[model samples]
Target: MLPIKLENIKLNQQYKNREDYFKKMGEQLFSAGLVNEGYSTSIINREEIYPTGLATGEINIAIPHTDYQFSRTTDIFITVLKTPIAFFRMDEPEKTVEVSIIVQILFDNPEKQPDILKELMEIITNQRVLKEMIAAQEPKEVLQHFQINN
Candidate 1:
């Protein structure tokens, strides 16, 4: 793991659409000098191809990511939307989603693979965890509630 913490991750208010969200996230990471120039575009492109939207039936989530080379350090950004954002489902490509949260992950190593997604999936899949996360108004509260053991 890198020296970066969840504190480094931010919930951007600038995102209106998926494109805007990613652009803003990339801009934040790039301007912070945490990633390269093409980082954001790469991740967003990969998201379009693979599609990370998850539908829990209660609260949907979008986990967008790329090939793990976009970051100078391994990190993740968690953004809670006051209003749900539309995304495409991973399993059903033709389906659309209304996601309440967006988690933008940057993996520095590809070997991490399913672990990261697995953890995220576990969190999002659990109604209890989802409720806690959604109820959290501040980023610090969010960081406090979610813990990554790996």
Candidate 2:
């Protein structure tokens, strides 16, 4: 199991926009030795080309990631925003989604990405789990929910 550091879990964070959020997140990941310095730029660029936002109907979420080469290890950073921000839908770039939760996935092993992503999408799309995650007030609560479901 990939470890999610409690320090990386942020709740009620405020950001000007999606780019600002990504940049800040990239900096934090780099400082934590989770990703390369260039990971941030790559993430922003990748989001522009391949948006990761998904509308679960219960709550909107975004899973942003970059190439495996940009990562140092496998880890996930979870951010729950106080105010939802606009992000382009993954399947339809023209469509916009208000994302309240951002899951920044960092993987050094390219092979595991597919399986991990599949599992992640399953959890994100599940209305019950999504609701629980959205309602979580603390990082521990969210982590516990994921651990129970994982």
Candidate 3:
């Protein structure tokens, strides 16, 4: 099972940009003992170099992450925004995608990132699941949806 706590799932959050969102979420992860102190900075730097945005047909999503060295454990933090934010697409950095969901990955083992990311992409691209997740009223609902589906 994924190390996704209900507390890690934020609903209807407001952030000015990717950096602000990452910093806030990173602080939560740090408090929960999921990430190291500098994890947020590393994530910001990494995102600048390699954007993790994806424009799926259902909804745009961003998977912000950094090296495993910055993580204390393996966990996934989800933040559903009140309004979509612009993020550079991973495949086409020149293009920007309006991201409604942010999936922050913190893993202690680098070897598992590829498989985890693949599964996350599959979940994000599923229209039905994505719609359900977006419409979920509470953090527990979001976690339940993921637990049942993934």
Candidate 4:
């Protein structure tokens, strides 16, 4: 299975903007000893240069992340927002997309990035899975959607 647990998944989170999302999520990961200090700021900086937002027709999403040096372990953290937030599109940085879900990826080894991302794309592109994630109230319900790879 993926290196994920109940603590790694947050449901119906409320945040004002992208910065708030990264900072708060970074804090949680830091508290868990999964990332170093300033990881949030690193993510913010990276997002400005390389936005992760993807438009999937029904539900748009963002996969925000930073360099491997900031991470202590490899894991995926997911947050389903109570309200959608606007993030710059990855394909067209000038344009923006309304994203309700945030998938924060952490990996200590740069080599693992592609394999991990490849696994994630399957779930992210599935509208049914995205719908289930937004509706999930419990952590187990959320995890069910991510275990397909393992």
Off by over 4 Å in 1: 1-4, 8-14, 148-150
Residue 75, model 4, lDDT:
89
- C-alpha lDDT values of all predictions: 0.74, 0.84, 0.85, 0.89
For model 2, how does the per-residue alpha-carbon lDDT over 1-150 read when each residue is reduced to its tens digit? 545778778888899999999888888778878888799899999999999999878589999989999999988888988889999999899899999899889889899888778767766677776677677888887787567546
Q: Per-residue lDDT of 1-150 in model 4, one digit per residue for the tens?
A: 466777779898899998888887888888989899889889999999999999987898999889999999998888899999999999999999999899889989999899888888888999999999999889789898788678
lDDT top scorer: 4
Give candidate 3's TM-score. 0.92
What lDDT, from 0 to 1, does candidate 4 have?
0.89
TM-score of 4: 0.95
lDDT of 2 at 84: 90
lDDT of 1: 0.74
141 in model 4: Cα distance from truth in Å? Answer: 1.2
Q: Model 3, range 67-117, lDDT digits (tens) per residue?
A: 999998888889999899889999999899999998888889999898888
Per-residue CA lDDT of model 1 for 4-102, tens digit only, reads 266754553445778888888789889998788798789778878888888987888888877766777667777777778788899997888988878
Model 1: pairs clashing at backbone N, Cα or C within 3 Å: none
Candidate 4 wrong stretches, greater than 4 Å? none
| Clashing residue pairs found in predicted model 2 | none
